[model samples]
Target: MGEEMPLSRIAAAVGTPVYVYSQAALVERAAAYVQAAQQTAARCLVCFAVKANGNPALLRLLGEQGLGADLTSGGELFLAQFAGIPPHRLLFSGVGKTSAEIQQALQAGIRALHVESWAEMERIAGIAQTLQMAAPVAVRLNPDVAADTHPAIHTGGRQHKFGVNAQAARQMLLAAADHPWLSPVGLAAHIGSQIRELAPFRQATAALLRLAADLEAVGCRLQYLDVGGGLGLDSISQAAPRPAEWVAAVGEPVAQAGYELVLEPGRSLVGDAGILLTRVEYVKEEGGKWFVVVDAGMNDFLRPALYGGEHPIWPVALRSGRQRESRADHTWRVEVVGPVCESGDTLARDYELPPVAAGDLLAVMQAGAYGYAMSSNYNGRLRPPEVLISGAAYQIIRQRQTMTHLLG
Candidate 1:
């Protein structure tokens, strides 16, 4: 807490239930990726996935570091422009892209579009062909690799909503060679997010490489192998490799294959650098269980409710620990919940919180990536502000959502 900004100051400026991201931390982290990729034989374009945390400040810092942009939406492309990332240094990826969105990417002159499905590849080709423009695209492959991640995040699985199957991709790549408007340039694979193990990445890369090899045999020129973002942060880095370590492990094949490697890193870059602060409002007991309520609800962070995700919750400011005479260790098992009226609104379940009282501060750690981006106006609670802190100084990047903003 001391190395970063003091939670006290951020709360004072933005009020509680706000998210604060450290710009310095984000910049330093981006530099690390650049350095690590340079160490390898691979010529890398480190593209920050704008789907993660698209705060203009974070994006601009990444651009200053010479990182590229990976966008999924038109707004994301616009954000990259605002962050000073030239369209040429950007790559766009998504499963469902409307015609307007594809046209926007084309006008932006993005580096490449990672086409996920056969239909998408055809759609992009048709759009580019009509405009008499040459489009460079990579075929996103569902390699059927079982990543060592939560089932819900496993995109390579047959049931997942992302990427074209290997068979379909092979057919698409060869067929794309005939399209004058679209250039078939590369292959892309993303197994899942928060993947901690090495074997799954090795498996995914090996499959993607093999698929690329087969396509090359058919006279397809493969210039880029995107290897889309899924690198994770260490909430438990004890088991998880740090950023550089993971990059080296996951990226070795790109060096061997002698292609330009594009990395779309989302959570690993921004997750640990931000925290969410909420103010405790009340405490109660029900069904022989202790409950501590806070102002930040599922509306503010849906990870817990949506994915049963693990977010380490802790006290922002330490208070003296005392023993309660009733319990053996004087600790009570507790469920930390939010103020949302829905019974499903829970931040965490069946854990321990400090003896919480009204006005106490709770900090949800490692929240920078999906926290604000996924927040909603459920229960009519205003979305929290976002802050960036440097030493003792702090600035608000996003103001708290106001009630009137919803009305409008």
Candidate 2:
């Protein structure tokens, strides 16, 4: 089946403003990386970024297939563990890790913690000392390689409050030997998200390799090189490199160094696997523009309003021949907006779409990664349900948020 089971059938059964995920697509996308890594000479660990889509059922499904979880907070760690990811299989990465969170991770024996600041490194060391445990740590390098993406998401630049600069990282690595509680085992850097080119990745890889070489020269033997994940998928019409291409680009250099490679992929593995199903509530024409108001607002799907993100939208029933609508050549340039009061709640502006009515269902494509994961109850609107579809069958992994739950 193609994208599978059709969004029309899903909307009919589950209602609008819902999220539908394809189980086959998710597994296939994840397995592509595993396959690519296996083909590489480098020993690799595939850690699914839990922040991307931390649905318990989804995480549990991925964990059952041997994918480890890459977490940013203690809550993500709990979700990953609840989903069956063992402590040893988790990689904790975040800028501000509380002492309590550090203690929790140390007690759980997580694989490695990507230490961002020297202060954070010290904090972890102190916590580990208190617990009488030696914590595995990796100093994240800033790299300063600017990826060609939205500036808000860029993480590796000097001004960004992400990893430490090269000099600071070098100092941290050298100082790690003095702290008996901290075992410096790796170096990590994440450039940004929604990146489409390979140059930035290659540049980041080379930078990390140089730092790794320098650290080794200074008597710091690193075990793994984590070239953090920002590998982009085709969100708009831009073509993205396949998982194999990405794996080859990043894995070859580290493979040559014989260091265990770790990739924390969030979007590329899940973005295209899901769709946001919404219903057109009204179609208005004013000021020489058509506005197609939808039931799902910024509270339900915020990517379009936040990142200026573009996702493909299609009529569900029209494509499936279930509704009496003509697939005419005529189209309307309409603004696909949500029912939120904020003017910024618009999903797409001046976009062309087939004529839609109040009852028509629209499927917002490439929504699996950040759609539901970033949803909220803003404006007191209840969050929609999530259905995982496998072939022709579908199961509601999450129920639509009820008014009772929202009120209470």
Candidate 3:
């Protein structure tokens, strides 16, 4: 993580079950995306998907690196603004947006609202009319492309309740073009998250470009083509396409078509940049199974329970006279469980780890993206703090939640 302060030292100071992010990693990833997009498209916007890790500090850091935000809710919209990202650099995207949220977005003057449904488009139009403002809108086209990822996260398939189908999307955009208060400005599609292959993205891009061309033939010009981001993290697979490759695959045709590119990357930018630190609470064997219980629970990191996420866990410090290579030979097959009172609270199942005592510190790798963002207070557990590491210095970006926070 490029921090001078040891992980054990930070864990000792902040207590266990804390998130630590590397500023250098965040900046490097953002730069990769931005540079790739810029090289591929003369005009582009790399909007960090705020739903991944909405820490104001992280948002501000990405914004400083010339990244905008792709927000889902009014709260995220507010967070983007609070982080000082200009409205022109912000894009609102989601399904099931409330009327109040629509009005809030319209009032905030974001670059465009990635409209998901016809009803949503109509709703935005009505609100914009009442406000006497022409709402900049983008139809979120469901290309019906099947991404090779978890079904739970797939959004672009026909069965998913995400964007409108291509035919319906075309009709909606055409209708919005003539509407009094709706300014159809872009076409967007987000197939799914954690997509490892480029074929799905290429397929989605083709579908979107064909629609854009059809619209253009009818004198309906679009400003941008938003192939919503799902570039998988390297932790998922090292063979996943790099930022440059991803941008070239999707952005080349769109750039040739003379449309600005907008990418909404979430996990790839921050996933590898942070980790969750926890302390081993107990190590026991029962019923021919070894369970290493840690202080962090599913409430602190829910990806394992929700998505069956397999994050590599490593000991922060080796015991005396233990060598890294030899320790693996002495490792035991174990299931890392948390303090939470649920069988689903297991973080890693049938994983191997070296010998660890009750007080040994463990680090959950590749947790920067969804780990803390999806956390909950479900077992009455307070959320852990988040720390940012820059060079040799570190700062607490978010304080640990207290009992009062839970009660509130």
Candidate 4:
């Protein structure tokens, strides 16, 4: 595979600032997920959350692995469909879903809509009724569980605007009883993202099981229980917990409670399986510190700026004579940044990178998930192209964002 078409060759052709994903790695993650949950539950469905990386190719591969989709917006729903995801395998979820979005989901007859609040449920019920269709829905419960990660991704807090509070979920379910246009398919909740510990997920699933019991006691035939995915992969490995563990922690709980399981995993699936390739533009020294400015910025990958995310940075080439075989001694720590002008626009605050001159290639590890999806045209800079690598070749999935493309 390395001899056929190494990543360095693709970066050389496309020019630096290219993102690529490995299909083999992604499939490995999917298989692990299936192996984990399939043991206890036959009615389980692993739904890949679309908001993390909306790339169609990635979705198609995940879908091919028998994974469904968890969508938050009309665009994501449309993207899911465009990627060949059947409406029956797609679940729409989000707070602040506009009536227009609800109408779209209703028309598609999606698998389920995880309604966030009582108000949204009433609206969905009305929309479904108007369309003369029964909207299969689930009430997202904010169990107030924390993922022990960054606060930005936290969604299960009572004060958070993500899901329906526990006290109100019961009442809302009762109110929803009369709305024949909607069916209580199950319950859903997302704790947060980039979580390292499994305890939070275990704890969160316990609460969801309890809520399912409460609903069942009230004569609600809850069919599904979605314990939202917040699984964290190693920052360096970009790989996460084994699928079996997640299934054991989540899928088993729903199975024990006699309900179907839906897992909406995002970053853990693609984050580590891909990386960003950029080129060094220039080098600068300030205040006795070295800086390696590259062509990539927060616009290309926002995780660093948004969550202080870290990605291993390495140079494409190393100087000769550094070593007889490997340029192991050429590596040095520097602040790898971009030309975005903001000090916060830096990509790696401090990184041990190979000695690189202008135009040398650098690979930013674990960047497949949120890398290009969160990119912007700030500083009038065009976003880079995206490539997908199989065994020994690369295909340009998305072209570099041209000035005309950005302007128009």
TM-score of each: 0.94, 0.95, 0.97, 0.94
TM-score leader: 3
Candidate 1: where are CA atoms >4 Å away? 1-4, 235-238, 318-331
What digit string (tens of lDDT, one per residue) describes model 4 on residues 295-399?
A: 888888888888888787766565454332323465666888888878888787767776776767888887877788888888888888888888887788889
Q: lDDT for each of the candidates?
A: 0.82, 0.87, 0.91, 0.81
* Candidate 2: tens digits of C-alpha lDDT, residues 1-408: 245586777778888899989998888887888888878854788899988899999998888767888899999998998898888779999999999899889998899999999889889988998999999998898899878888877888888999998899988988886678988889998898889999999999999999999888978889989888888887656898887898899989998998888888898888888989999888888898889999999999998888888888887764333342443546878899998889999988888897778888888888998889999999999988999989878899999998897877
Candidate 4: count of backbone clashes, pairs at least 3 residues apart or interchain: 2
Question: Best by lDDT, which number?
Answer: 3
lDDT of 4 at 88: 85
The lDDT-based order of candidates, best leading, equals 3, 2, 1, 4
Off by over 4 Å in 2: 1-4, 319-329
* Residue 220 C-alpha lDDT in model 4: 78
Q: Residue 22 in model 2: shift from native, Å? A: 0.4
Q: List candidate 4 segments past 4 Å from native.
A: 1-4, 236-240, 319-330
Error of 4 at 242 (Å): 3.1
In model 2, state the lDDT of residue 103.
89
Summarize candidate 1's per-residue lDDT along 135-210 as a digit string, tens digits: 8888888888787677777788778888988899888888878878888888888888887777777777788888
Report the C-alpha displacement of residue 218, candidate 1, in angstroms: 2.9
The residue-level lDDT of candidate 2 at 135 comes to 90
